[model samples]
Target: MKSLTLPAVLATALFALISPAIAQYADGQDATPEQAQAYQDAQGCILVLKAAGGDDNLQMAEQAMAKAKELAPINGDDTDEKFAKSMKDWEEILGLASVDESKQFLANCRETWSA
Candidate 1:
């Protein structure tokens, strides 16, 4: 019960942050190529993480997240407006579906990619 609560809480918070970004896309606004690619990767990772109950699925999610992170631009101080916005969107996805092994995978991705 406690374990389930954590993921639920995290997912709720993630959704809170994600709604606005999603609305932009929903309004038929176009995302840049980089943003589109990153969104696709993160969306794939999140779906796999949410449904995954095995190591194989977890691995696939991790790989997808890694690719998403790679496509996102890193900004020290997050001063680059577009890059910062893109990362915020990507991080929201990480928050939404990451749990247990998926959380560990996100941590690893951050560590490896941090500037």
Candidate 2:
């Protein structure tokens, strides 16, 4: 297979890094730094899976689901617990974002955290 040129590799890396910060999910106005980071990560996975499409999309979705199932439930201060639960919930849906219910997952993120 042909290798990617240095510029191509750099561009891809930059895009991948920035895509996560492109508002894939909303961090509530009151979210703490930790919560905000987790929220963004979950959003990144969701957005990535959505953009993957086709069979690859399903594969990405499955990996997300498996990772989520392995995570322990939230168990800490109110702040930690809230974000933990929120992250777990949003991320779990990410594994299915390329399937028929993909939009449902994104919708859940918006509806999940209403002001």
Candidate 3:
């Protein structure tokens, strides 16, 4: 029998939570400026999470996310519709890779950002 994996499980849960806003983009609808910024910032956080390989990774990720929030400040509670939708969009774009792939991307992000 095939076993369920963590990423698969997470993806399934994400699909259930996210809105059809993902599909809206496929029809050539452009993201608003706020949406674009949120996606960009989330993508950066995803990289930081991947790069944080030491014991404090989760803390690092949380700090980075909080800082991003302070800087950009999206609306609504995380469980609320609007915020959840934005998270869904951000994850749809930035959450595709496996762990190894994310690590590779993290390395690249570090190089690009540090230069």
RMSD of each: 10.7, 13.8, 9.7
Clash count (model 2, backbone only): 1
Q: What digit string (tens of lDDT, one per residue) describes model 3 on residues 1-115?
A: 1111223433354343333334444555544334533434443554455456654555545654654454333322234465545555556645666776555545544443333
Give the alpha carbon lDDT tens digit for every residue of 32-89 in model 1.
4335434444543445454544675566566655655554332111245654565566
User: Which predicted model would earn the best lDDT?
Assistant: 1
Itemize residue pairs with steric clashes in candidate 2.
61-95
> lDDT (0-100) at residue 89 of candidate 1?
60
lDDT of each: 0.47, 0.39, 0.45
**Tens-place lDDT digits, model 2, residues 23-93:** 33243333443433443434334454556565655565455434333321221213646546545544444
What candidate 2 gets wrong by more than 4 Å, as runs, is 1-43, 72-115
